[model samples]
Target chain A: MDMRRLVGGNFARLRQAKGLTQEDVEARSGFSQQYISGLERGQRNPTIITLYELAQALGVSHVELITPQNDET
Target chain B: MDMRRLVGGNFARLRQAKGLTQEDVEARSGFSQQYISGLERGQRNPTIITLYELAQALGVSHVELITPQNDET
Candidate 1:
């Protein structure tokens, strides 16, 4: 699987599901909004630590950030 | 959330559940057995790409490598 795209799709979906903007995720994860935006576009290669931080920001398990949801990426 | 330890525990569990050794994963994932050992011991930090490769070697999704299962870790 394409980890970058998969994580991008899942991150976008999860963040949206939580009614959070990239800026909100940035505030919560200590990651910049630009980084979040890039990740959503599958343009960033995030490590597991980044995934964990983002997942926590979205109020979800880290697993959710990497799982391929139905018809999403 | 210590991502390194979490991935380590999950990876070890998944690998063992598949009845495969570190050497087996090494051969399949092209990651060294020594590296796999360190990772399983929570001593290594793996990128998302590494997680994906290890997951593929274990015949599972990348998410499986990061998921926290019951009574593990």
Candidate 2:
């Protein structure tokens, strides 16, 4: 299981759960919607700080972004 | 609570629990001992891949490094 995909999937799931669009995350985290799209597509190599900011935007722990889900991929 | 310190503490605690030194992590993760030392001091802002690799070296889940422990910091 690739970590990028794992993170991407988690991000998408969390964002959807909160009823947030990419633009919502963009406004909250100051990361562009384009970047958010790239991240959700598993195309970004984010630093820990990026992970931290995203977690902040989503109102969850940073660890949640990187944790593997119950569904095996 | 600083995430860097949290990660550093977790890394240090886990490594010590396993009786492994920075040298041992270097051998397993191909990261320099000096870098490991810096990371242990919370001086390094590691990337996601770095976190993943270090977890591999430590034989723990990557989330463990970033997760806050029971101790108050």
Candidate 3:
């Protein structure tokens, strides 16, 4: 239920799944690579606007970033 | 690509879809109603942990919250 930790974990997983680097997201989303890194590390608190941009950059819905996968059936 | 605007829009849509009031999410997610309102209004910059918690309370994956629905498609 920790948003930061969950987002960081999910972000890392999704980014890796898509074979994307932080730099790529930064370039696509116009967010700084350092900011993305901070987000992945749970060190940054992003506004909703930032999250939407990140989702767009990732080619996914904004919900995908906040939603938890049903890994446990 | 504005994260806050996207999140706020999506949040409001989802909440309306489920007939959920901000208080309902607040009770379920342990986040304050005011906070949820602010988030929906794109007024709050939540940490990843907070986002994750909100997702749980909403009974969806974290990704769902961050991901944008393909309404056009």
Candidate 4:
């Protein structure tokens, strides 16, 4: 299912939906902007704790970061 | 929310609920039994890909590994 791409797309979707930039997530999550950028591009595999922190910073549940939307359906 | 503890507990609970041992998860997940034990014990921070693999090996959604159960309610 290409979970990496799914997660990246979902993360990007959610962040944009919230009107946030990667820098905002970096500031709130204590992760570097490059790291966040990598995650969104599916170029990095983040730890569960990182995902949790990013979710918190994005004002969303961690589950939302991995669940794909209906676009595939 | 002590997210580390929460995720570990959730992972352990879900694995136990499925009646699978750490060894069983290791065999199915291709992750080391020691690593699985550490994760269950809240001593290891697993990557998202690792979480996904664990969930797949456990026959559950990745979200299940991070969601807190109702016992906390």
Collision count of model 2 = 0
Candidate 1 displacement at residue B73 in angstroms: 8.1
CAPRI verdict (incorrect, acceptable, medium, high) for model 2: medium
> Cα lDDT for residue A48, model 1?
87
Model 1 chain B, poorest ten-residue lDDT window? B64-73
Worst 10 residues of 4 chain B by lDDT: B64-73
Candidate-wise lDDT, in order: 0.83, 0.86, 0.72, 0.79
> Per-residue lDDT tens digits of candidate 3, residues A1-73?
5566556667878898999999988877788899888888977666565666677788876666666566622
lDDT of 2 by residue, B1-73 (tens): 5767778888999999999999998988788899999889989878787788888889998988888877833
Q: Pick the candidate with the highest TM-score.
A: 2
Poorest 10 consecutive residues by lDDT, candidate 3 chain B: B64-73
Residue-level lDDT tens digits of model 4 in B1-73: 5566767788888889989989988877688889878887888887788777877888888777777677742
Clash number by candidate, in order: 0, 0, 38, 0
Clashing pairs in 4: none
Look at candidate 1 and give me any clashing residue pairs. Answer: none
Candidate 2's error at A28, in angstroms? 2.0
Model 4: per-residue lDDT, tens digit, A1-73? 5667777888888999999889887877777888878877888787777777778888888878877678832
lDDT of 3 at A50: 65
TM-score of each: 0.88, 0.93, 0.57, 0.83
- Candidate 4 stretches greater than 4 Å from native: A27-29
User: What are the per-model DockQ values?
Assistant: 0.80, 0.71, 0.50, 0.66
